[model samples]
Target: MAYSHDSVADIRSESFPDYEARIEDAYIEGYDPASLGAPHSSLHTRKLWFGLGLILAALFGIGLSVWGAAAHIWGTGTQIDLSNRLLVLGLIEVAVTLTLGFVLIASSRKGYKEYRKRTGRVN
Candidate 1:
């Protein structure tokens, strides 16, 4: 037999009398109750690694673009050409990589600051 809505509600209320208060407390604490067991240091470290990885990838893209531009301009048996579609594409790639790297770094720094503030850590 299936429990009616009222019966379910009654059972829930009987089992958890302070559910509303607990939820309110969780809100005030600025985190979900389900995440209580996870350590904040792990989250911080993961963010650091993610930020570093993005920076490295961005740098790699910029380096590849620079290398391609140099090779196109200075390689043997190739005439020196300044005005080319490939140069424009390489410049665009550099600009995009720089923009993405800056944004990710800034956001990660901001998140680290917030984490420090939340955890009351000075260092």
Candidate 2:
């Protein structure tokens, strides 16, 4: 929504004074938008999309593992060695998939918090 000064609430929250350096200083001196679930001036559109893509990929990896297990694609065709083969493959899949998921979460959280701090916002 476009915020206009005619609105009373907008005057208080969306308000800024008529000065160039003052506005920049205000942002640099702690302009957090955590109430919006986002830190202000830290995340650009492209970076957010990239992070979202990483999370989507991790979820896809998990889904593929489930499909492989259910279809016995995780196992060798040999009748006798099928169980052991599936077990090994399943373990490998779990390890890699979980590791990727964890890394994605950690990296995103760290990056977000660091951005907030760097922009002078208190978490």
Give the best candidate by TM-score. Answer: 1
lDDT of 2 by residue, 1-123 (tens): 998767656464457756534233544444545544553332444545465555556555565556556557555455543544554565566566566655655554665576556556555
Q: Which 10 consecutive positions of candidate 2 have the poorest summed lDDT?
A: 39-48
Cα lDDT tens digits for candidate 1, 11-121: 766887864332223444445433324343334454556656656666655665676677676762555554354556666766775667666666656744765676565
Q: What is the lDDT of residue 24 in candidate 2?
A: 30
Name the lDDT value of residue 9 in candidate 2: 68
Per-candidate Cα lDDT values, in order, are 0.56, 0.54
Stretches > 4 Å off in candidate 2? 1-81, 119-123
lDDT score for residue 7 of model 2: 65
TM-score of every model versus the real structure: 0.42, 0.38
